[model samples]
Target: MRFIKRLIIGFVMVIILGICLYCYARLIEPNMLLKKSYSVTVPKDVKELKIVFFTDTHFGKYYPQEKITRLVDFINEQKPDVVIFGGDLIDSYNRDQELVNIEELSKSLKKIKASYGKIAVYGNHDYGGGAEPIYEKVMTDGGFKILRDSELTLSDLNLSIIGYDDYLLGSVDPNRYQLPDAPFRIVVTHEPDVIDNIKANGSLLVLAGHSHGGQVTIPFMKGVLRPGAEKYIKGQYDLKETITGCDATMIVSEGIGMTLKPFRFLNPPNIVVVSLKHK
Candidate 1:
């Protein structure tokens, strides 16, 4: 009887510890590198456009410069015509005092060349990083164009990338980009759940983060629970044809780094680089 009791207690302790570890990895000290290959068909005139998007980097207090520099280097090697960084660029707990060197990371990212130019949006972590002021400085000074509930068009690529503000805080403007009667319209956002209501309306593709793919998913099943995960979370899925009948693809990234946790299980950090190929 005594031995059985001890075994039960040990099992319970392990379970508790596992949960704690997952929480940290998912929310606290998670360091991840995620890479995926996606090819989509656009008009032959599209000329194989590639875009590298970095999301939820949460660089603050713990994560450092060398790590981000390596990521930036990899992005350059991809040679994307345009680069998009989904926000949370800085992570801080002081609520007032900023942590990490975002300027350096921004400078590194600025080195990534794209004919169309780089763009980005805000995440919940961006809110923690002093929202507008700090985030604006990091990107604009670091050579990135921060889009606060606005739209920017790339005439050369014949593509339009729409940027939406932070999803967590609510009250973001969704402005329409005057797309040049093209076959594809791309939109960039920090969170995935928001797209649930967005259907495929006038857009060919939607890119988002904030799910972190549960930061650690087990085998043979979906994530135990994804943060802010709507019906579609992690990986690529269809948003369904709207009553208006729009054809848009939704790609949700597992993203890099952890906001509240610091551990990753089956899920690793990653960057989504997809080519607009001839399908």
Candidate 2:
């Protein structure tokens, strides 16, 4: 009888400890930022451009306005030449919780300074729960140009940026936009799965954010898989090789917010800074 009682007590303690750890990871750890830098060749002859990219600010239940303000401040401090937002600006999934203050969020985001310009794309969460228009409005109001299945060229610098829509929600067709002859060409999308379908004639770099790094990763165990992000979870990958006569690379950000159960373990939020140079 005494041994059985001890076993039950131990089980109860374990459960309690698990609960505490989960809470810390979901709430406290979500606010922590993991900043990383990378250097890539973009085929341009101009000076190196510093690009700061981040995404998935699910601004509702767990994430709030203050977090975004702080994030904007941090990005500004980086003095990025071009700022890219990967998408999912609003957490409109939870019907129980009130929506994030879109106006305030837009105001906060507008403070971010990028010398070249600020570009944005949409994620699956932005389209989920019928919040697409609201999210778009917020981004536009904040001075972010929404790029959807389109291409923008910086004529002066000989750089071209193509924006592919979300894989599930918007158009994922890479065939629509032809790769320009610019020395530097980039593709920005919300889903990293599109990297598989990209057919490029020149050196191309694609940036995306949707997986949130599985949002909850455990050692030796797989993280939660979302629909479109089942393949690329986090970090960078080489989609094509020069050995194959083509060069392309893709970067999938872990993102800054959470969804569904609101928990993250081992996978913290990320702010990626990439420097582009001539090959």
Q: Give per-candidate clash totals.
A: 17, 0
**CA lDDT for candidate 2:** 0.80
Residue-by-residue lDDT tens digits, candidate 1, 197-258: 55344437778888777766667767656445655568887654531355667788877776
Q: Please, what are the lDDT tens digits per residue for candidate 2 over residues 1-279?
A: 999999999999999999999788967788698787888886546557899999988877767656877898889989999999998877774451355767777788799999988999888877886677687898988989988888887665667788878889876665754554444478898888766665557577789888888888878875997777888888888877531435777788888888887788888887999988766
Model 1 residue 225 CA deviation in Å: 4.3
* Candidate 1 Cα errors over 4 Å, as ranges: 1-32, 45-47, 93-99, 174-182, 199-203, 220-227, 242-244
Among these predicted structures, which one has the highest lDDT? 2
lDDT of each: 0.70, 0.80
